[model samples]
Target: MLTSSNANKKRTPNRLSQHLDVLLFSRTRLEGIKQRRAMWTDKQRGIRLSQHELLCKNSCGYYGNPAWQGFCSKCWRERVRPAEARRLDTRESGEVTTPTFSKFEEKKNMEKGRRINTMRRLFWGGPSPPKQPSDSQMNALKAFQKLEPGDFTGFLKTLRSPSCQRLQSRCTAFLNTMEAYHALQVQKQSDLVQDFYQSFAEYFTSFSEAELTRTMEHVEKLIMTRLHKWVFCHDSCDDEQKDLTLQRRIRSLNWVTPQMLSVPFPEMQSTITGDPFLPAITAIIEMDAKRAPQDKLVCVSKCSQHVFEALSTSNSEPANADDFLSALVYVVLKANPPRLHSNMQYVIRFGLPQSLMAGESGYYFTNLSCAVAFIEKLDGRSLNLSPEEFEGYMRRGRAPAAASGVQAAACETRHLLDELMSRQERLDHGVDALNVQLQTWVQAVHAQIDQATSQLALVQEEVTDISLSASSSTSSDSAEIEHLILTDEHVGSPDTDC
Candidate 1:
């Protein structure tokens, strides 16, 4: 019994030593795992700090947003401030508004900003002081600001005077026109577009299928011609793009017209209609019906005509062809509200005058009569010209030398008419010489006055045809003689006799 007890006691000591060795191994593995985890944690912390350094570090200078997730501190406050204010009045929060300034006001604001900035820089360190306006520029600005309606005549004279030198030109080229004039012009065209509807009353009553067909054909030609012209001006649109754009426009026009025309204009008439397939047919019918009295001339799209048609439309009217085209696109967008573009709209709103005023590229289509009409409405006289002299003037002034040239041309015209009227010369032979002399007189006018160039081109073309036809005449023309006698007094009014 004593021997068995001794053996058991020896085995128990061996078991205790084995248990201690297993505990030591386990502790070593746990310590190694902890060290690795600590190293990994340190690496992650370094990476997060580096990423933070790269992002916008500027504080928005608002409260609590730095604690919030994804919100910019300054932006959130600004956005919320308007909304919070509306808590009292239910008005919707408006966008952060930008203040607009006139040239003089803008200059003043800029100077103020510079002063503030300069003071800051003096305290700290920054850019040099801002450049100041010249004395002439300042004086010009002051003078233009003080100009009243009654000052219009005096303004022109002053601007033209030696004192202003080139200051008037510079101010006009920069500050005289408002910054938004181009945008305003475009908006005006859009507004006046509805004035054209009255002209289409005749079409509403009688919508012919043949007329519709002709309109479609005409519109297709119009589209191709316009696109071809556009591609020439905008070289950025490559040949492939141009072809794709043309096809898209053709398809859109095809789609849009049918959709619009198919809807019955119950207001138009009881039975009149056009092809649903062609928008041009629809437009042409309207255009044909809209024609003004042939006796006197009228262009519905002209600023004067559109204004006369609807006084309120001046603000809404489209400025030019681009404005018209854009308005059509806006119309299409509002109706369907679809994701569109490419093949979704007409390349241009169709018309002779509409196409002509598109830009410099469309200048080829300019009708001199239409241009004369337009120029009359566009700024009439330079600020330097006297209102009395300007009002009575024949040509819109180019320069002092140019105006004097017109007087010279008129004097020569009087001499030529005197020779023609004296009847010392035969009507047959003298007419050619008279026509040649008249052509020379206009050519001289064209050389001196830029505006007269277009006038001369139109006049010369008609004169050449008349001179050739009249050359074979044999009758003693007493009526023409009377007209020649009257010509001396109205030499400046070239179209008066006609």
Candidate 2:
């Protein structure tokens, strides 16, 4: 029993010793694993910190871990940006800085070398630099790089110079010339309008009394045809041939005085003996006998007596013999007597200007030439009066029997003046309307200029505001750089160094 117990004790001690050996081996394996993990972690952290320090030093001339670095990434980026920008600027400008051999004298040597090289390249093309420039070369290159007058810089300078007052004067002169030209054009237009009126007058005035009678007959026929069409509703007419016959008849009709048509019998002799009306009537008869004795006489004694009585009773003066003779001529020449009265009244009311009356007489034939001369100066084809022919006509004097011709001329003159006045009134109305339109156009131009000026002012204000804002931002950035420098100086020292 003792041997069995001793064997059990020995087995137990060996099992316990095996258990302790397993525990100790397991603990040692765990410690070795922890040591390897710590070594790997330390190596990785060291590598990261070293990489960060290298990057910072190269980029910003400073070195440290990223988190505890003296300078921030933003600050480092800002500092490097200016250096890169300066390098790029130098490269673009074709200017390179040479390295200095000695740090103590670096700046002085670099500056001297730069100046010498620049001067050498400027004055000499050969390998050896020239000692001095020739007179011509010096003069030529002295101002070569400078902006001259009429160049971009010079132009900008002149724009701001007081000498620019000359531009305002030039603009004023141009405006004056434009206004003068406009006035001359207006005068030319006025002359044209007047010439048109005068030519219209001469066209009618040149017609003989026989021609006047024919024209009136033609117009009357046209009026009659139109009236027939309106009353009878016929679109076609055979009146053209009949109108020509009527016109021929009207032209053939002779002008005669009232006295030739109103020879009184013995019953009317008592009123006519030594009477005032007798003298006027006798004058008309004698004038008619001298001028146109072959003309037919129509005795309307009762009408003649009534006309004389009406003239005597009315306060208005008796018609002059010349006027009476013209009236007698008009009545005899008309184809349709009833329409003649109204037409005659229209002719007398507005067509009795003395200048036109004088132009019709052989004595005042020079005035007709003047009218023709004026018309020839116009540009239109409607009426072309040759100035040479008009002057020739004026140089020649009047015919022998001027007085008798004057009476007939005055009647024709009245008709021409009436037609011209009507045309002139129409032209005046057209000119007034055109003036109104021109005024409107001028107003519109002024308004457009005003609007453009206002918009330009607004745009200039916006540009000015933007430029000021940019300048303020630049100043703020400069202030930030100074602040960063101050912060670096304070933070880089020891805790008690501030």
Candidate 3:
């Protein structure tokens, strides 16, 4: 029993040591795995940070974002703060400095910065300052704020301007009339609008025709700019439904081509040959970006001008009105601009009657409306294509196999096809010319061979006639010559003399 106890005690220490070693090994492995996992996580985090890091464009040594125009948040705050805030800050410093000549220069600098920053905030994205009214209605209310008592010059200027308090009052009155009509569920808003314009003209009776026309235009802009949000593409109206239908129609017709529309677009060899239609297309696209009727009309005019410029540059003769309209149609198709129908209706309904009914601006706007109308009713017959072909193209959609290319190239497959067609035409022409020349040469050789055969036949006939005549006279002539020679020899013989 004592020996057994000694052996058991010895085995107990060995077993404990083995258990401790296994536990230590397992812990060490777990720690190593955790360390490796932590290293990998940190590496991934560093890669993500490096990939997405954007330094402030103002060199402020901080991160930036597009919402702040590539500026850090701190820089954006400084940029958007009004200059008056800076003045207030200086005044609140509570210590009056000694007056110096440089004080005048400092004040001038402050005013300059104030004007610049105000202009910047007005044009760029930022909160509006007190002096600049961001809203059209607000502008009208504040127009008189800059005036002093008995400032006749300022009053007259304000009265003459579109932002005049008088015009705003008239607009507000008209707006109330519209709201009353809306509340009464009246459908004669058009008549009310026309009556309002007539009253507007009465208010400016002393102005010249041109000045009145211009003022009316500005008034239309102010009224429409305010009315646009309330009325444009409203759910209560059919404009939204029309917009959806037109968008879907345009999407389905994405495979349309210039040829399909008979647009007579210039056949360009390379896309890099200056995209003449780019400006026109861009203008057409920007039509959706504007809110007011006048602004949209201006976009239409710009598109028209760009289209005309492209047409004039491409053709030897000046582009006619028909060509301009056709090119405009093609531009609309290519751009497939969104909300085209709604925009056209908006301009037609709310645009100034004087502007829409007269001048080149009116003419261009009319043509654009016509182009949209044509597009709305377009079909295979309109494009002069068979229904089957049109449907086939529609089925193939915009990314047709015949027109596929890398997006970066910016060249359409149709342009490449057009170039290939031209090259093939030149090749065919050369082949035709070569075939004509070969036929002519072959004919000339054949004629020369016929002449040579006739000459050979004539020479053979002459030789046959000479041979027949010689055969007929040969025997008699030979016999007579032999007799004559014998007689002469007998007379001259020496034996006969002896």
RMSD of 1: 41.6
Please count the clashing residue pairs in each candidate, in the order shown. Answer: 15, 0, 0
Q: How close to the true structure is residue 383 of candidate 1, measured as C-alpha lDDT?
A: 18
The best candidate by TM-score is: 3
| Model 1 local distance difference test score | 0.36
Q: Tell me which residue pairs clash in candidate 3.
A: none
Which regions in candidate 1 have their CA more than 4 angstroms from the true location?
1-139, 146-248, 258-498
Task: Give the 10-residue window scoring lowest on summed lDDT in candidate 1.
Answer: 291-300
| TM-score of model 1 (CA atoms) | 0.18
Writing each residue's lDDT as its tens digit, candidate 1 over 1-498 gives: 999999999999999999998999889989999988975564332111122321223443211112212233234334654454345233332354433446435655665577456433432234543234457645653554445533435556655665455433433332222232323332222112212212221222233433432332332232233233332223332434644443344333322221121121122222322222133222222322321111011221332233222222322343443223222332222232111221111121222222322332222112212222222232213212345644433242324333453575577667668977776557756888989999999998877797677788999999998987786463447667778878866785766766
Sort order, lDDT high to low = 3, 2, 1
Compute the lDDT for candidate 3. Answer: 0.65
lDDT of each: 0.36, 0.38, 0.65
Give the 10-residue window scoring lowest on summed lDDT in candidate 3. 44-53
- How far in Å is the alpha carbon of 175 misplaced in model 1? 16
**How well does candidate 2 match the true structure in TM-score terms?**
0.19
lDDT of 3 by residue, 69-178 (tens): 55544565457544544565567655976446477458657866775563333322233422433365355435544455434455457666765554545567667556
